[model samples]
Target: MSKWTEIRDGMVSALDVSDVVESAKDQLITDLTGDGMDALSTVADKFITQVQVQAESEQGWCMVRDKFVLPLMINGILWAVKLVLAKSTPATATQPEAPTGDSQQ
Candidate 1:
């Protein structure tokens, strides 16, 4: 998935975070009802829009992208190192045969 999508999904799904957002919206509505119920809705809508805008910004995208891409890059580096070590060591030298001492004579 793209970085922004990952971030958006994370925000929507993890840690009861959406509840917090909803709670904040509810609080705003309660506090700002003097401007009328319609104004409260508009404020809530604007808040959501601003969150989306921030998530899609370059810095947010890069942070989310690194969360995924960094692990894959580390795995690739580890695999390459293992491959090089395996190639350097002879198989026979590494896996020694069991001793069959000449007791069968």
Candidate 2:
């Protein structure tokens, strides 16, 4: 496989693992009470913040794509997936509403 393919696969795997880990942490918090829940929440928050920082880093984007465009595209795809799975009704097709007032030049 190509290097890019390998990198993509690795990233997906990492994301999956992160999801699982977060779930497990959540479960632990649910199963515990008081201090345990607070501790787990603190750790989870730190982990999430670290991941976000890494994801938004300039070097992180450049290491994969010379430009940051690819990451934005990937983010868009993930957003679409969430929209597809969400419980709300799918958006209805509608005509664009014309300007209610006079159009600006």
Candidate 3:
């Protein structure tokens, strides 16, 4: 199971409603949901950071292996996807298009 799902299940299992009022239960649910969202946000942040690092490394590798068609294709696809994503969503910053040389084609 996913980390968020595990956290949610744990929270649900720990809730003691025998003596709690209905309003209190509602508050508890809201608090638990917030906690879950916080956890998810943390996980997402970490993933984005790792992806950024890996992408940088992949670019270096592509430079070294420029003659390989596979690397060029992979980089091209990544750039296209990034462009599509940036257009569909909000732009975090201006992202320049990936450089392509004659060897890439």
Candidate 4:
């Protein structure tokens, strides 16, 4: 095998993406749904609740403001989803944070 191939395979073997994916999926699924309901279903339920709540809020957003606000709302949801996934997956399964050396007085 080529050196690059060996390095790529070693990297892949070191990280079990399936474990991280499964763990993150499991967490997004709330127990709000009883047995027999799968993770996707629970994720959808939570997603709907978040959007519905924001839509129902008294934002006083007019057509001009909504053009900007709608996208911001979607961005907010994306941030929330990523945060949950990061929390669900083990620290070792994800990339390590870069070091910020040196202290400021």
Q: What's the CA error at residue 67 for candidate 3, in Å?
A: 23
How many Å off is the CA of 5 in candidate 1?
Answer: 63
Which scores higher on TM-score, 3 or 4?
4
Per residue, candidate 4 scores C-alpha lDDT tens digits across 1-103 of: 9999999999999896766765555554433122323454466557655655666554655543444555567557656765665565555546687778765
- For each predicted model, how many residue pairs clash, with residues at least 3 apart or on different chains? 0, 0, 0, 0
Two-way lDDT contest, 1 vs 4, winner: 4
The number of the candidate with the highest lDDT is 4
Instruction: Please list the Cα RMSD from the true structure of every candidate, rounded to 1 decimal place.
Output: 26.5, 19.3, 19.5, 16.0
TM-score, candidate 3, is 0.30
Q: List the residue pairs that clash in candidate 3.
A: none
TM-score of each candidate structure, all chains considered together: 0.33, 0.26, 0.30, 0.32
Once model 4 is optimally superposed onto the true structure by TM-score, how far is the C-alpha of residue 57 displaced, in angstroms?
24
lDDT of 4 at 95: 63
TM-score (C-alpha, index-matched) for candidate 1? 0.33
lDDT of each: 0.56, 0.53, 0.56, 0.58
Residue pairs in candidate 1 whose N, alpha carbon or C atoms collide under 3 angstroms: none
lDDT of 3: 0.56
> Whole-model lDDT for model 1 versus the true structure?
0.56
Per-residue lDDT tens digits for candidate 2, residues 29-78, read 34444454456556655654555566555576454552445545655655
